[model samples]
Target: MSQDGAEFSFKKIAIPAFGPSILFGLGEGAILPVIALSARGLGASVAIAALVVTLIGIGSLLSNIPASILTDKYGERWSIVGAAGLSMVAMILCAVAPNLWVYGLGVLLIGAASAVFNLARQKYLTEAVPIQYRARALSTLGGVMRIGVFIGPFIGALAINFFQLAGAYWVGVVAVVIAGLVALSMPDLVHEGGAQSATGAPTVRSILVDRRRIFLTIGIGVLLVGAVRASRQAVLPLWAEGLGLDASTTSLIYGLSGAVDMLVFYPAGKVMDRRGRAWVAVPSMLLMGISLLLMPLTTGALGLLLVALLIGFGNGIGSGVVMTLGADYSPARGRAQFLGIWRFLADLGSFSGPALLSGLTAVISLAFGVAATGLIGLAAGAVLWYWIPRSPKTPS
Candidate 1:
């Protein structure tokens, strides 16, 4: 079919394309806020409870390459279904856990399943959407996930009133089952032609070796971006507490920031498609970095809220940019494998960002640590500005 025809066809698959993502986000959001609390209830110490929360990132980090292999072998639809099934089992385990260890294990498995689910949908969309509309498509996907996450806490709060803390896990269980059902219903699209190995499927080692340059350059930028973004979460609450804000006030500020974050995605995506990736990417990092730098100076709730909104707007505008860049650079034959590596770098940054902040805070002060994170954000902006292609290179 013609390019325009194919682009129009995306509309037909829109529901199947984005539905599972929303549900997955809902499931994750429902449980994320309560994981540490649940761990504490299960007899975990403060340190152990925090460690339990990190298990999800650890699980995802370890599973990225494996998840890619699964996506490549079984295809996107089955991988998504499998991920959803795994998530359901994980949530059930969390709900019925007899000990803190069991609950932590469940959280880890949930992370691993999330890696698979995310990679599959991204790979599917990368192949199915036409190049011209790829940015908007991916951005919409990101936005919908945010929408689900934003709404999920309310549902979890209601459930908690009836079922207590475990109610969140129950909500997760229901969400993933519906997500899996939606994945099962999605129509599988045929992949376009690309070079295949004559020897057989290429090894992950070979794919990485061939794409090492991309990984080192743009991949580094991705890492920095992930670090800065993840650091935002840590900076907010810590700084709020340092300023003597109560939990309810902090939560209100966070919710408002998120509301701003959800608003700019589509416009940002449109600009990326029409202008270029750097157009949104560079400014996003800069805004977030500036906000972080300003955060250290805030002495009251109003000042903090304004900075948070700026950071949120910055982050929201950059939604789907990382995924879009991955799609653009990924080779047709080993796309999933490449994205697996790409995601690993991003997730690595995410895992380390907060750890870095904590270490810095331990050594210096909260303000110093936050300012250092802001520096990382500025560095990311510079890297992306220099490295992001002026025009996207759509891989054949």
Candidate 2:
């Protein structure tokens, strides 16, 4: 088939492939807002509750390489199905937890499952989509996830009214089951005997040796991007509490921001495909950094809303950029292994973000810690500006 024909086929199949991601993201989103609150309700401190949220990142970081191996050997379809089932179990565990420790364990398992699931999808897309259409395809996937997140909190709020915090996990459980069924129903895109890499299968040692420089430089920027994004999620709720906003208000603001993010996904993808990845990357970090810097200055709910708008816009514009960049660097062969390492670094940043914010909060003020993330974002923006072009235009 021609390049255009292949791109068209990939695009057509992409939406179908996104079914599980949307549902999984929705389920996860349903539980995210209340994870900290539930831990606190179970007798944990504020910092400790936040730490529990980081457990997802930690689990993802630890599991990425192994998950990659699974995807590489088993193919993408089964890995996704397994992840969906495991995540459902994790949600059930979270729902039944009597204490913060058990709850953290459940969240950790969900994170591990999510890492495996996400890596499989990323690997599939990198191979499935053509270069010209890659960013758009990924951005659409990212957008769908945002849609799930945007819809989730409201569903969670309704669940909370009926069953409280535990109810949200029930919603997650149902969502995961639906997602798993969707995965089960989809045709096996991998091992359908599509394009196979000429370079042979990817191994960890070979990938590490080959991709070392990209990981050290541009990859670090991707990590920081992940860090900033993760920190925003962690910091915002705490910041809202510090401002004395109620739970409803916090959820409303976040949901609205997510809506804003969803609206921009397609546009962002177009910009990346047409202009360059840096076009979106630098501006995204700069906007997010500015929003974080302004966070400490927000004295009222209205002020916080404005900051959220900026954050939402910033985050929206960068949709799929990290995945796109990772795809750009990933070798055609052993793509899963390379993506495993790539996501590992990104998840490391995700884990570090909350921990770093918590540590800084303990040392200084919450405001200062939030401000520090802004500084990190700004630094990341600079790195992206310098490094993105210098990085490989296509996989080596």
Candidate 3:
């Protein structure tokens, strides 16, 4: 490449992507908190609310490849715009839906929006960063994105409390639109190659077929991610209300956790760059599992805040290490599809963890539900611990 060829910076992309990314991240984080309550407000039962999450997961699973193909065929910019546009529609539909069945369609669309937006965003990152710096670059991006998420729910809660359900929906629409527009402003990476986006015509089928173990690992990571997230996003709102707190406070707690993620995420990435992927990810996962185990026993905000810190720290490692590893393992061709494999399962975990854990509490107890999820996370860490191949670290 010529020295005069175009180059990118964190400010170049991160600044524009930040707004949309935040909207996307926040929606990713907050919906779990709101879904059950919103359903109940529309007169759905606990059983059905659980089903709502399951259905969303199904939609995410269905949309993964199509989203990748669309990104490849059209371009990353349009893919995100299309997704955000659909999400705007979905949220409005969700607010107005008269019945659970129609509401389910809204949920499906929301999941689909995430699929495309995520693919575009990741492809953007892959195209923008150099290989030596890729891990930290992705980590920095994750940290920023998490900051967006951290801000969203707190504001959403204020809207929910001040203006009721419609207010919350309105806030979400604005966020989706903002994110979409920012995506529009960014430059597109037309040609995919080198350390950045993939080059060549490898089939998505080959990537998925040969990397079954990696896919499994991704699934487990997603489950744990979604599992830990569900505890806060899906179940915590209900738990908080049961404790007699308002929606505002619940959002604050969620927001605080997001803040913690932002603060620690970059530092964690640096450690991964210096130490190694497994070195950081392994301990982060263990801490995350331990934090989940601790959540049920802690009844006070202070205790919960500490738990959030631990969980956030663990997540910081994962957000960096996992993406770095994904980029490393994935061949230059069909990178989006491989990242989709990474994201697809995690989204499944995100959708499933809340509902499944909450549903389990019906037969047992919330304490048991939290504990079960935490234990599963420990197993996930162990799995990654055993199998994550060590790659040669690039010179700084």
Best by lDDT: 1
Clash number for every model? 0, 1, 4
TM-score of each: 0.97, 0.89, 0.81
lDDT of 2 by residue, 328-385 (tens): 8887666788889999888888878877998999999999999999999999999999
Q: Which residue pairs in candidate 3 have backbone atoms (N, alpha carbon, C) closer than 3 angstroms, thus clashing?
A: 20-179, 32-233, 33-233, 198-332
Per-model C-alpha lDDT, please?
0.91, 0.85, 0.70
Tens-place lDDT per residue, model 1, 345-364, is 99999998999999999999
The lDDT ranking, best first, is 1, 2, 3
What residue runs in model 3 are displaced by over 4 Å at the alpha carbon?
A: 1-8, 26-34, 53-55, 157-163, 190-200, 216-255, 295-305, 355-365, 390-396
Instruction: List ranges where model 1 is wrong by over 4 Å.
Output: 1-9, 193-199
| Model 1's TM-score against the true structure | 0.97
Q: State the lDDT of candidate 3 residue by residue for 1-396, as single tens digits.
A: 001114645565666655577777766555545777888888888978867866666777789888887887677788888999999899899888898888889988888887788777777666566665566767876776677666666678888888787666777788888888878887766563544333446557877887777677655764565556545555455556556667778777766666666677677766666666777767777887788788888777667767776776676666656567666666556777777777776666676676678678888988788777788778768876776645434422
lDDT of 3: 0.70
Q: At residue 351, what lDDT does model 2 achieve?
A: 74
lDDT of 1 at 180: 95
Least accurate 10 contiguous residues by lDDT in model 1: 1-10
Clashes of 1: 0
Q: lDDT for model 1, please.
A: 0.91
As for candidate 1, its clashing pairs are: none
